[model samples]
Target chain A: MKRGIAGSLESNDALITVKESDKLEITIKSVVYDFFHKQIEKTIRDTLSELGIDKISVVCEDKGALDFTVRARLITAVKRMEASK
Target chain B: MRRSLLFIPGNNPAMLRNSDVFESDAVIYDLEDAVSVTEKDAARELVSGFLNCAGALPMEVIVRINGLDTEYFSADLEAVVSDKIDSVMLPKASAAYLAELDFLLTEQEKKKGLKKRINVVPIVELASSVLQIDEIVKCPRVNGVLLGAEDLSGDIEVMRTKKGNEILYPRMKLAYACAAYKIDAIDTPFTDVNDGAGLEEDCRFVANLGFNAKAAIHPNQVPVINSIFVPAQKSIEWALRVQEAARQASLKGLGVFSLDGKMVDKPVILRAENIIKKARKYNLI
Candidate 1:
């Protein structure tokens, strides 16, 4: 299983972890989960779809990360995962 | 020149969002020591993304790229060499290092088709760099020097004092070089963020030595540095008085003029004129 990580658990940042999987799967745990869970998931999905990445499981440990932050972390994680392979 | 340049970690999304809120004269998104090696790529991506979307920042924007010696230097340049940034702060700055950076910056400018070249503010921290400060400052695209006493102290095996006594010689040497070269001399940050009085004392000490500005690590230090570096209203009034007195003396064919029972001459008038000029530039008048 190839796994890659990016970002931090600091305030307004996300600790993004991506692992090899059978299909695209995302799990989000956010400090602002009550309000932004959907938005965060949508961001991850949009980013993965845009990058045309598949067969990866993305776990976004988000700490109130904005749209850009979420996208950046996901992209960085994807790149790191690719580099490891 | 900016009175204060606030250093913000490139990887922090929160800080990046509120960077301009502090009202510092400039903001330096740092891609160097503040970032961990593992996260260098993340920071680079975040910084470039932020600058791309953060359109038209009110104050001057700068990026402190990794030094030329590092493997990330090229990528750092590729990420940050944009029109949004007015300058880039190069760490571990030396004559040789600056020569390499100058060539690279020229190439970057050409690649981007930038009509205006990016300016460089080199960090004068290493022992070897202090000796070659003149050569570094005289290098192409060099605009200013920020004396990083923390690294300089460590480099020279000296105790870094809050009073900044140990780095006095480096301070003076850097100030002299910058003054001669007509560039800004920015003092390093006072690391103790809670000690406002100590921060003021350090600012005054360096300002008296002809340093025009200082770098701040925290938002609180911004106001403190600006208060001392910016001309006070009283000084502006006094400068106007001296200016009027000089005009009167010139009209009367008297080389010397009196301002509040004190004899004022060429140098005195020039100093007052500078104060007024700076005030005007800062819109303080």
Candidate 2:
């Protein structure tokens, strides 16, 4: 799969996108970036590691989404990517 | 006594976060049709995480998991059959499915160590299930029955009318079955959010037909359903009068009583007693 996306730009939600890539990369843009950037990144990384998923570029566009929402979106994005190929 | 059960899309966090404050007696987090097939996993995680993390809210929490036939059913139960949820609303319901659900839910409760036994409310939509409603409602785990008119309409090959005549037989069947089993008889939701009058009329019609509660698709419909489903002031007053008359008749050693010059039998007295009980429960008196 080239690309897969999950969630929406709605409030309390984050749009997560996963792209097939040679190396792992993570980028996050959030409304509360300075306050939660590291925390959000840690959540994403912890979730990916826990799920045993690797070698994908992750992009999260956040609108004040909580930890659960972020994790759900990323998991959904990965499932979508896997469903394609 | 859930007068209004608001259906919140399980995938939507904004609504899930504010479920308690919606003025609904119960909130059902929908994991079935409200979610697309692709996001089923995401919704399961999101709902379980939110329910487990958010702690207990004021109102009852019910999760409408996918039917038992689907692959998502067991996963949904694994994620949500916890203390956070008060009940499970099963779509595509049957006695066999209820039996399976009862076993699975009990297993989940034992596995998760949930002290509370999760209730099961089967959505009576399949035509065969409608015919076998009495058997379904008799299940040990069933606490109520929710009428799914939309799917039943299609299953029976009839278009759902504004009057909802297509589902009348099933509605009465559910009402009777639930009454026989002494459980909640919840009506199907009114599809039109914009037509308040139509919704009100529908609620009143079903309430008169013995539906104790109605499902609300939107927040605007909550107040309307609560108003109609709750013991109305007029009925409460009449029930009070009936109780007073019954007390006097019993004191006089009479087996019968009269209210407003009409004979009040055992059934009428029983109905009045139930109304008074409901009013007291709601603190309406």
Candidate 3:
């Protein structure tokens, strides 16, 4: 029911998109997939869970964003989605 | 000795990451006017998380939250209150607002078990607050006062000019009140970011008017503001000589001394000591 995009494609940032869905689904694309892949996924999941969001689809294109930046982009995308609805 | 306080938007990660590199005396992570209504929560979370992770920042970290009149005030405080923050910049500040903020900050400190008390710096932006400047600075947790020229000018129905003719009275009132209270008086930012000459002139004018520091909307203005507020090399040398002479006089059981054939009193000695202290703090000595 809701869809939004937050963040930029610039370095040290993450381009995130969120859409309403029946169940949680996440897809991440990043250059540092080998070393930081799990950490990045956990950050996204933790942020969504903190916001009381469970049914959503997220696509994160990361450019070496830290945990805080990832959380910020994800929360922004979720807020945008909620507002759209 | 805050020569410059740079304002960084809370929602922008790039800006926040690069904040520590600017070398400003203080960096204000702005969550009030800079952050939109919808992204308030996101910005708060980001700032809180970033502060929590930042081990030891080179400069002071101040968080500027929304005013007490807004619903976001409580949440903003909750999100940003932490041991990492050196101070909280309260926008549109007044006596009542500062009192409430002091109470809330105390509660937050207790809740978080913070070892040190966080200071609150008031921003006098409204005409009503400007009228209550004396009372506002007298609040419990206020360590400094910053003039918000844009909002103050708007409130008084005057256009903000680069010449800064309209807001002179309010600026002077705030500076005088802060001086009486022995607190820092910070001037507003020069809005035109591209005008280097104008920024230098404005900084000199405010610094000469007894302002302790000036705010910067951009990082590039930080160096200019710092240079203008810092004591000149010749003045530093003069202060050093005066201090040394005073020390020798004190050892000789004298309350006054002659420096460069001019009578130097206790007040003059104190001024020289203060100048040297500022110079040392800024690494100019």
Candidate 4:
């Protein structure tokens, strides 16, 4: 019983991607994931849970994003993805 | 009217919104050289929305649009040029660009029913543009001309020396052009924001050269630039004493008088009047 769905963190030199879904819809946003990936990942995960969607994916387009920006953007993408779902 | 004009990247929404909080005479919403081509449309949309919602700030607001040669210039012009903003900053501008922008701005003003004229601030970023300073400054719609030191340095392939001795002639010519036409001349941004003392020295140098204002790349530089342009405390005191002497001389119907062993002529009186004006502006009077 996968209530919400899955979230994946994809890393790249210039960007990062996180995907989370309940198998209904998808949303994506890019952020500077520079060296702050850990904080950004946590923020995205927290936002997904808050949206009550267990399945989620977050994607980040990084140009060396700061920790706070990653978190802020991840939260935004999760909220947007969940609402569209 | 911008005592200090802050340059905010056209794409950054947070910075654009936060710019209003920085105490400056104006904030330049930059869309031209600061922004990459791919982000132009998005930046334009975001700034448009921000201008509509941002509360009336104490300073003037302007948008720096892409050059006429850029692919997004037309769209940038169409999206901006509303009555909400105070002026438009044209980068790498020529007299031709001035004509074109003024035409479009006039049309926009008519369509939007704006009461005030939308002024234009052109940047002399290229060698050719600098050479055409007289022609550019003479344009009616053009309010002022700014020296784009970074790009000019790159364009001419000269390394930017900190002292700025390399562009001395160009700066003098620009000052001359602005003075001849009675238009405001603005100095380029001082890249080193950490060097407050150096920045103040540069502001004084430019003010002495007759530049009306100087651009600031960071918020910390704003106060220094503004304070430097203002009359000095000692100078203010002298102006107050001179003004009082002149008032007393007027009571005696003496057009020329001496104050503290100094002969006060018309030019001296005028200088004192100018100082009084500056003092009044700062509430020092």
Give per-residue CA lDDT, model 2, range B1-285, as digits (tens). 679999999999999888888889999999998999978888987898788778669998999999999999989988898778899999999999899899988888898899899999899888999988989989977888999999999899999998988898998888888888889999999999999999999999999888999999999999889888878899999999999999999999987977788999788999999999999988899
CAPRI rating of model 4: incorrect
Q: Evaluate residue A17 in candidate 4 and report its C-alpha lDDT on the 0 to 100 scale.
A: 40
Q: What C-alpha lDDT, on a 0 to 100 scale, does residue B14 get in candidate 2?
A: 93
Q: Considering DockQ, which of the candidate structures 1 and 2 is the better prediction for this target?
A: 1
* DockQ leader: 1
| Model 1 agreement with the true structure over B18-49: per-residue lDDT tens digits | 99999899999999988999889999989987
Model 1 regions lying over 4 Å from their true place = A33-38, A49-55, B250-256, B261-263
From the highest lDDT down, the ranking of the candidates is 1, 3, 2, 4
TM-score of 2: 0.91
Per-candidate local distance difference test? 0.91, 0.90, 0.91, 0.74
Instruction: Please identify model 3 stretches exceeding 4 Å from their true place.
Output: A2-11, A20-23, A31-39, A46-55, A76-85
Docking class of 3: medium
B-chain TM-score, every candidate? 0.96, 0.97, 0.96, 0.94
TM-score for candidate 1: 0.93
Instruction: TM-score each candidate.
Output: 0.93, 0.91, 0.92, 0.77
Clashing pairs in 3: none
Per-residue accuracy of model 4 over A4-83 as CA lDDT, tens digit each: 22212333212324455555232334454344546655655665566566654445555443333344344444434444
| Model 2 misplaced stretches (Cα beyond 4 Å) | A1-5, A18-25, A45-57, A78-85
Q: Which ten residues in a row have the lowest lDDT in candidate 2 chain B?
A: B48-57
Estimate, for each residue in B1-285, the C-alpha lDDT of model 3 and write its tens digit.
588999999978888888999989999999998989876877787788789878889998999999999998998899888889999999999899899999999999999999889999999999999999999989997889999999999999999999999989888999899989989999999999999999999988988888989999999899999998989999899999998998899999999889889999999998898899999998898
Per-residue error (Å), model 3, residue B141: 1.3
What is the TM-score ranking, best to worst?
1, 3, 2, 4
- Could you give the CAPRI-style class of model 2? medium
Tell me how far the alpha carbon of residue B198 in candidate 4 is from the true structure, in angstroms, after superposition: 2.2
